[model samples]
Target chain A: MKVTHAKLLAQVPLLTDLPTELLESLAKSCRFEQVNRGHVIIERHDTTRRFFFLLSGQVRMLDLNRQGQEIALAILDAPTHFGELAVIDSLPRSASVQATTRCEVASISPQDAEKLIYTVPQVSRKIMQNMATVIRNNNLHRQVLQQQSISNRLAAYLLGQLPKDIDPKETVCIRNLPIQYDLSILLGTTRESISRALTTLVDEGLVTKDGKNLYLNDIPGLYQLLEED
Target chain B: MKVTHAKLLAQVPLLTDLPTELLESLAKSCRFEQVNRGHVIIERHDTTRRFFFLLSGQVRMLDLNRQGQEIALAILDAPTHFGELAVIDSLPRSASVQATTRCEVASISPQDAEKLIYTVPQVSRKIMQNMATVIRNNNLHRQVLQQQSISNRLAAYLLGQLPKDIDPKETVCIRNLPIQYDLSILLGTTRESISRALTTLVDEGLVTKDGKNLYLNDIPGLYQLLEED
Candidate 1:
């Protein structure tokens, strides 16, 4: 892919204040690959060699138990970066990353990435800023997951999608949200708990459910649920 | 403190690589304060504007529940940085920090910290790297805490403190190690569990306990416990 294509990959908060030229240069060096669904891009404890950016589809970051139960950590969608921590810390992969769908990913080996950063200081700064945002968001998410209860966590998770001071009457479309199983893992709860919470919301008329989709019926009630003791 | 003192402070991994003059300037602006035991420096969700560096003594970072139960997250010791996350993210404090001992600390306002970072690029880079390390360590600790049983966690915790390839016959001192309560929080287990594990080790002649101190008597045994299924 041309370096111009990489320009489309940078998100606002993650790569804020970067010059277009730097991003173009970075995109030029990235090696793009198409991976099938369920393909493992990286495995836990593997040597850290490459950093990957998702161009399309979803990737799941997860850890496996000795008995082979997988605990999903985070899901990386389009325009998101992963495996950078390994490069930064010079450590082995802390978890496994696998394609949840047919994924188009661009990767830069650590050696190449470091060389680019050294040669292009602007790109390095932008990358650092991007990493800082990732760390901050991860920490905030972990904090919410640790402190909030299952129900409150579900409400907060939904509220997180809406803007602060959202209109009470505004109906929120939830069909495009990530998979329920992914949500359950991210919130550190079971799928049954998530389904039950969604059912309760629907029963209370706080949300409307149709097949696999949902829409907010009472945003105020949803907010109240989030605030409940 | 003199410029030399500031330079010495900059020797910390977080501040290393910053310009000497910038370090001197930041040190000059820092306010030195003494905190008595039980003093709260930062409160969870508090909109405080100051950040701290532990110059001497221990400071405990804790998460508080609605019922007012406190869970210790980390213990900040000499020359350690704290409160940088809140400053960087421009968010309310996520955890409370309290003095666990009569200690001297240096503090800087968020504004000044930002100014120093902007003016001294190296300082900003160092700060970013430091925060990254903290995030990585925090995640690793949480993973270990969540996955391991209390006994295994305690054993892993102890084994982590020992040097690799230590002789099985060598006695390792634990007097300077963190207090039991702090250890309990670190391992995400209870004080009773820690006590019981210690007692078991003592009974098996794998460790010796005297007053508040412990000595490792069987390094291989501790490692085996850490590796148990």
Candidate 2:
């Protein structure tokens, strides 16, 4: 395999599992592109016939309502993929994707991606598994974000990041949260409101913040706050 | 084919398109069950091993945040399917499914469903297509609900339900929205708040309440309102 093709395929967990021959075939069809920060990879309601897998950098899926208030649906890091809807059904883009940072992405024509899935059994299973994962995570996230209360939203968001096997009483540190401004956008609140909510959380003994990292010393207490909402 | 089996298979839009022999084979492994109103067909965090297809009746997909605030994800009518995550990958149920009305349902083991998807090309394509449809609708619904304001939320909700082919200037009546209580739960607001939003829409000449229906007289005006918020 070519070094660049191998690197891109290795980055995406889904493509790494494909057999060498199939990977070689897919790599041959792959087109490499570099997108600048704030570049819109796809636009809402555009009927385009392409699928993109982010090889490096960050991509934000943006939703802008009629009032022009924009919220992010998701922020995807490299090795993650987008645009599978058009790949599957030629559907118009429902949301826009913009590079949150200068990014490298590998492009595949919908026809090429469809051919990989339809004609290759192993590739089909791997692709389906990846799609299932996207659907599962999306449902779980929508459920959490549906909470009405800001504190509840924050608590739920925190608890969601905790390791599943961790005990409730253990101290947990959550890192990698979006900054306050972006978080407010995701939670549909103002920066001031989000700050106030965090302060309230701190006063209530649910969490402590050390810069960008948050410490949860009373995990069960936080659960109680979420439960009592 | 058994008459009951054929009847059940024919009712499901996803399965009706499959060959009769294949459907018959699938029906052989099916287990029929009757769920009462408010029956919990699936539970969040439950590691259940089956996927369900609603043969007759109404079902609500629900999400309860850690705060115990419950919201309905969707209200699915018969001839619809759910729980493919477990079938495809044996993942735990991410959300709950409850019977909104007394209902009849047929279930297939994940093993059996996997057999069909892996061995039958047409069945695999059909299932994937159905999944793509679900993912697409989920993304769109999430986008509409991500807006920050209640009035904006209500307006976006109404606009989303409009038929795609309708002209922007045309008159449209949206009916069968959840009752105020349910709408409040779904929209993350109080019944009083939802009422206020609707009244505001009426006062703005964007929507006119006619009995149980909402007549959207100027679709663009409603959209403009959505943009301004």
Candidate 3:
């Protein structure tokens, strides 16, 4: 089965707002490539201004913290875009991206991206909306990182993972806990620390795990952890 | 002497790209207000979508960390804008804003702002650029906050304060260190802790302070602090 470039571009959230002709034009100019796991997709401080859209598989966004330790900013899955900031604003890449799995990605030159943004109302508005989301997510990440204790940060992250409108009295089950390795990266702690924190929550009867599903037994108690020092 | 609304709008970085006629139309829809020190300008989770431009004085961006403590995210002086994220994306305010000094500001309805962004290429690009900077700064802030100790975070913050192009061998002086109260808030620590951290840096000969000016006596040594536990 062959997927047309235009079909792939149309699947992107940012380009979905674009009319068919624009998407076709974008499809024509974009360069598509596939790489195996651990291949660097983008390097930190690289000045190349290209917008990348992930069509398949996953990539890890990595940056060095002040301690020169490589920290995972995020694990981005397919049907998403990265490097738009550098393309739109001409800033150097702030973080590096490496394939976590064999991945297919498409990249468009900065000039073409800029032209589409300037001439197309839908594309411009969508760009702003997407950037707004990135800003909001980053702000939330900073708030979560500000938690001084691992368990407190873990509780906050769990609370975030739950549905926003979940009933406080309802016993909710979260089936999508990231694997221990990814959890450690997201939580900025070691695998041992993540285990310890989860145990602390389970021992306190706030959460319970059965096989792959983790149940939030006491939502209020989990919230209370965030208030503690 | 008085400032015309259009004249004020012309001074905003986002609006600088707008032509005079567009600026004038925008000015017609904006409302001006004056707030005294400590007045809450925008409450977090508030649904109101208005773009505010500070004409005078200053405001602090504040949010509650996971521990339920208010942390200062940043401070903005006059001739700046906030709330664009909410205006564009219709998200609830992510953080609150309070006047740090007596302030004058103007706000535009979301419709006018969106209209300008959709119709004006320069304005749209400027908005994206501004959002890009916000995302980058947030990334850096999260990296700094990930440091385990106050002194390490302080050192990272100090390094950030220096000019990016400063010569490594040249001694640099920073006269614009935020007031101790603000620095404490920025570093997520107590004023006493900030004092302790500074004394440690000074006593170690990495920094020297004389009155209001602080000199980076050993830039490389300061960088080394971040690599420590």
Candidate 4:
């Protein structure tokens, strides 16, 4: 998509609630770029000052171990945002983000974003509100992860993926699976362990796995597994 | 301190850069109060619209666990601030703060702070700057804790207590230390482990513990311990 067109569409709540004209101006100040799969978008400790919005495809935010093994911190799908922390704090990126698939992204320099926000009160309010949501969600995830057991963590995470008002008994199909390695990192376990756990669930008729897709066969059974003594 | 005096002192900063009469009016809006040790200053999930500034003594920010354990997240000493997160986000408190020692605090209702800041541009700038500093420090601590090992984390925690720009070789004394249980929670470990580590450090001549006081016998040695395999 052309940078102008992409920026116009980006104003769809995820970017800001600014008017089209304002968003177009903001977009003009930003740069649009495509990154290939396996491209490192951001590097830990790199002091580059850019905020990113995923326009298409996926990016995995990861922290590297001493030996450089990547541990997935989060996965940002299209329409989601990342790199706001650097812009907010004027600090180096805390974690690296790598393209999990060929992706399109919109980039805003920190100075540009700050200038726009200060000059536009509406933009500043919208950005602050967006940041507040991010902070709230991040804090909630940290709390849940710190307190929940591995199984409970996985269950809660899966449940969160469902619609907010969905019936508890509703069977939802999950497709375009997040990689097992990513799941392992999120659960603070090994991919082998995640595979073993999923296998157990499948054998028990709790969930059905077909290739890269999974369907909830028994929601109660999954809950039982989460609550197992 | 008397409420009137505390209110007056709180106005000093807000008034310094504002017109003299405006500062006096803002000061009149503040509410001063003393809270004894163990008093709950702010309750979790409370939407009470008040922000606090520490005048004296210590306060602890805590989150309660399901098992009823109070996880101490931070200690706020004199001249420090708390309750600003709720004010900024216009949300209920996510954590509770209590007086760890008899605390004298000056408070401004969120509405009052908002009014004063809106009327006084200088006050708004100062408050924003203060918030940025607090957020940056909080994020830095979170990153350090997430990335460092237990020993290194402990060492860094101790180092943070010392005066900045002090000679690295200079030893500092920590007196009337809090209980081991408190230290365990702060370091994300158990009391037994903290006791064991302290004993080991003592044996290694890195530190000395006598009664309620700990003397760092060798600052460089403590740093080496943090860098150990």
Compare the candidates by DockQ and give the number of the best one. 3
> How do all models score by TM-score?
0.77, 0.86, 0.92, 0.76
lDDT of 4 by residue, A117-149 (tens): 444555444555555554555444443343335
What is the C-alpha interface RMSD of model 3?
A: 1.5
Worst 10 residues of 4 chain B by lDDT: B139-148
Which digits, one per residue and each the tens of the lDDT, describe model 1 over residues A55-133?
8888988875333456576777776767766776677787899998999888887987656543445555555556556
Q: Per-residue CA lDDT of candidate 1, range B56-173, in tens?
A: 7888888753334466777777777777666666667878888989987788888996665444555555665565566666555544443446666666667656765777778887
Candidate 3 Cα outliers beyond 4 Å, as residue runs:
A1-3, A209-213, B1-3, B209-213
The native-contact fraction of candidate 1 is 0.05
lDDT of 4: 0.66
* Candidate 1 local lDDT, residue A64: 52
For candidate 1, give the lDDT of residue A116.
52
Interface RMSD of each: 4.5, 2.1, 1.5, 4.6
Q: Give a tens-digit lDDT track for model 2, residues B101-139.
A: 799988888788777676677666767777787777777
Considering summed lDDT, which 10 consecutive residues are worst modelled in model 3 chain A?
A: A1-10
Candidate 2 or 1, higher lDDT: 2
**Lowest lDDT 10-residue stretch of candidate 2 chain A:** A64-73
Rank ordering of all candidates by DockQ, starting from the highest: 3, 2, 1, 4
Q: Weakest 10 consecutive residues, lDDT, candidate 1 chain B?
A: B139-148
Score each candidate by Cα lDDT.
0.69, 0.77, 0.82, 0.66
